[model samples]
Target: MQGVPEEWTEEDGGTGERSRGTGTGKGEETMMMELTRLVQKTVKESSWWERRGIDCSILAAAFISLPPAFLLLGSSHFLWFSAGVLLMGVAHGIITIKGTHLASHGALSESQAWAKFWAVFFIEICGSFSALAGVKGHIKMHHAHTNVIGLGDSSVWKVPFLSRSIYLFIAPLAVPVITPLVALGRKYFPVERDNRTVAMVTLGLYSQYWLLINVSGFTSPLSALLCMLVCRAMFSVPYIHVNIFQHIGLPMFSPTRRPKRIYQMTHGVLNLPRNPLLDWMFGHSLINCHVEHHLFPFLSDNMCLKVKPVVSKYLTEKQLPYQEDGYLSRLQLFFNRYQELMVFAPPITELVGVQ
Candidate 1:
């Protein structure tokens, strides 16, 4: 495969290579280089505190809030218990979406050992998914080959036979129940497995159940189980929606025609409207800062947001695609054109003309 630029081939850094280009030639390279310089400048200007503080606060929130929420579940008042469940659900979502995501990318800590430790903790223990599997499926596959069929495609959620209503509405509610089963099944496949990750995940999940039953004062095992399911469901719906929304309707590519980094990400990824709630819970990589995240996958979410203006402006000035759509607009597109957008294979575009 040809390099994006001679100096910065994916093979040189193990970042993964683009298999093809859009044929825009030197002009494309010039635009990409300018964007790269801007990103480097932004990185240098960023403070150490800015780089690390948001992640620390997010981690603290996930750890500190869960125990109190669990204790509140023991309250006799219905309102109190309900409040506890809501808080617990929100905290767990942050752990899964933001905390585990950062750790999986090794963005949470500089040390590989510490990064792996927290990745396992947040993903397996709190998120009820396999850390090793996530690193393989998400980081290795999805990020390396975004929107490429049989690789980065988000086809897990695609169900062709289901009626649009059921597929869009009712199916998302089951994501919480389905995610762990999928994770477990992936473990049995020929993919890489970490014995420590499996053991830790097993222990963490069971311990959580035990705490919910005994310490949380749940009246019965069934009640504890129900609480767990409900809390996970709160995150699952939006999680499923966001995963599909960001890339499903965008341009896809055959592996042979995968464009260079900037072209591939800008063409394939999208940014949704700003939502303060999701920004905090899901982090910038998965929200309005998505394009920036793709361009700088290793940057922490805080840094991604900080550099967004430079990235966005450069893309716009160059007249390259910088896709953004409202959350509802995406939903409407998904509903109205479910077949073309989700069920059927996405159409791949070749950039044929240039300045």
Candidate 2:
């Protein structure tokens, strides 16, 4: 109730009575239009550093970490091996989460050819997911229907049969393994067949296996496989949790009765406070500036962070919602209320009357 609108109540099915004083009238619409213009202007005026310079640096760092990681993993010493595996996992997470995310959104490049190339390289080669599927699922569906029930609501992550403990702690360890299998399954199952998705998914998985055996000096296939599993699961818990924490449990909307873009994004999306590791690994767009990213999906992570203050202030001054919650608090919320948040269909936030 702390963050809920004054008129909202569960008894009313989240459709609070319309009040002209609550800033959901024509004045609110005008303000939202102005806010959009302001954000667009901010994006256009963003410096090269905000556009792609920082992303390039992050990508470079992720790539640079790899050789050393392989070297360390290949070492005969146990401590050396452990350290190398840790570095390898961190590098992989950064590349997949940050690099792939940006590339998927076409935020990393202005050139169409380069964007496609990066998408293949980051999502397929590094992330071990199909670039085509990633785009179709994330960009086309998720972004277009954020918080809309049964579509972009991140409901796929929910597993009702599993206990909360296992869902939270154990199940996520399988994501790296499950990701490729799902991609391969998609290829055969054929919603829309693309030879490239299967090809790249296979190539990516095989490449990593080859690297583990050759460059990482694993003596046996079993050893190499073990190393792969361990490294991939390093950040798996938070990797899965972050996806759900930011979107699920927030106000959901009926697809047919969704609010205006500004209201939907502002009310439904929650931003976690920035963490140094998460910021670097997941990118600002996924971590701290999620609301801004949802509002303008094309902006780079650096640009999202740059525009956060302006976005937050504008929403605040206009008395619109600007949701921000701490990471640990969200985690606890999910852990404590997993059944309500993860297992059930969240009640629709009825904004039709208000809007």
Candidate 3:
């Protein structure tokens, strides 16, 4: 509370905390500036490993896990093959999910050139998605507009025509197949075509196919293809769920009447408690420390974890909302409310004072 803006402090006529829906312009600016300073100071004091080295280790381990997985997949034993497939799927998930996420946000490096390099490597070569589209949609649109109804409220993930069970359970399994096709179709692109994006995506798809047949020792190309699809979609259910559960049912705002960044993010974003598998697959930034990630997009996953206590405590002391929910709880909420939350768009929450 030491950094709480004087205008909104208990001494002033105003309440110690701004309501979730509104903040005075000056108070909002002052509050964010103070919080920004605190975050910066905390980040600056942290070591290099906390900021970047741990992610490097995580990426390296995921890569290391692949060779054994391939060996197991090639085995004559059914149990060994099954174990191998599971291992391979988990490794692939970690690399693509955690790698693409960190690289997309430039959390791996300070240099724009290195950032773009990693973005292409992880997103295009590993994830088989266009790096340009990923950055444009995620950083520019999603992060910038957050819970603004038409822009960043995870609307794109919804399919009104599909029943809840189909959408949640069956549909996501095709994500591995659909992701590149959607990118190629220019569904999310701003231009008519991007040759580099198309080429890299094609290369990634072929690389996976080649690996499945060759290293995984599948004699039949058709069998290899099936193996590829199954491994790739191992975590698709949670992947789809995480995308929506974090933002969709939260407080949504009208695009034209957005609140300050702090209020918008705190009210709109909800963090799921950590699970060991999810933590490894999606990085801490995407999981338990989502609010911190949205607030400090550049922070590495380790850095985000380090700052979680600071962020949660600061918000609490200021009487600002700090949204956190259980993973199972959110899953149940979505399951029960699918029709209301996904099939039809929810109304926007009108802030008390803005515009």
Candidate 4:
């Protein structure tokens, strides 16, 4: 709510979604039309990056595997291995953030068939996620419906009194443990195919990984489990944090309502500032760039980054909202104030302007 802009209001007629309010003045405010053209132009120029083959770079996995590979040596080096464990965490997280997202959108789909195979392998085998399942859940269900109650994938909405604090922050840390249950919940309770596949693949990956670690004659069973627990926990924490900030703390409309494309995107999705480290590692998947990814999903990570400025500028000139923040600051805010940010009703008044 803090980063929420005044120019944004919810349209209440059909499908309610947070939208931008047009000001009467001309000058800078008139740039919305120009901004839209720039966005279109930049995206058109970003085609080359999408065709490039980064996903096929198998060496990325081998290189990233180094830290985790060292831990499989089975030596009395827990202290040193601890650092490796964390690196493993960072490595795996980056792979998931970059690999799965790009692949899901078909941005890395140069080889089509091979790309799908590899992307599914990375998420299922490396990231311990089900490729096919999560893709649909995200691209189809979530992207199509941002912050729209049970429809949107925005993880920010929370239960009654707890707000987003406990649900978004603390609960997300438990995701490594909980997602399996989430998957299980879907399986038995009559959920979607993708949801069930996500669970099964998760179980399969971890089971195979543990067997492989054991076969290597690595540390005792206890140590191996500890390493895994830490690895999964570390990965889940940052990912969940990133997800919660993406589309929460905005507006949510009903089943039949919808917001203007730009306003819905501007208010539903947030930028979350820029971190050079994360930018280099995860690139366009990090912030409001994600919405653009959702929009022009065929663009590669590099191309997405290139077009990000154009999109951000489009939102700003339209007097639209674009939320961003330092990671540490947001983490602290999650612990302290995030809960209050969740679960707000649509604005009583409606705003104008639609195509």
Identify the candidate with maximal lDDT. Answer: 3
Candidate 4 off by > 4 Å: 1-64, 71-73, 153-170, 184-216, 328-339, 343-355
Could you give candidate 4's per-residue lDDT for residues 248-287 as a string of tens digits? 5555555455555455555666666667656645655565
Query: Judged by TM-score relative to the true structure, which candidate is superior, 1 or 2?
Result: 1
Higher-ranked by TM-score: 2 or 4: 2
CA lDDT, candidate 3, residue 25: 77
The worst-scoring run of ten residues by lDDT in candidate 3 lies at: 7-16
Give the lowest summed-lDDT range of ten residues in model 4: 1-10
Q: Which candidate is the best by TM-score?
A: 3
TM-score for each model:
0.90, 0.89, 0.91, 0.72
Task: Give the per-residue lDDT digits (tens) of candidate 2, residues 155-264.
Answer: 87888999999999999999988988887767533454456777777787788789888888778998788888888889889988889998998889887777766777
The 10-residue segment of model 1 with minimum total lDDT is 1-10
List where candidate 2 sits over 4 angstroms from the true fold: 1-29, 187-193
> After superposing candidate 3, which stretches have Cα over 4 Å from the reference?
1-24, 187-193, 353-355
Candidate 3 has an lDDT of 0.82
lDDT of 1 by residue, 1-355 (tens): 1111222123422232222344545666676677778887987888877787777788797779988899988899999999999998898888878988887777777666677777778788777688767776776677777888878888767889998888877887787777677766664434445455556667777887888987898778888888887887786767778898999988888877766766788888999988988888999889999888877777788988999999999998888899999989998998899989877788876745531
Residue-level error in angstroms, candidate 4, position 131: 3.3
RMSD of each: 4.2, 7.9, 6.9, 8.0
What TM-score, to 2 decimals, does candidate 2 have? 0.89
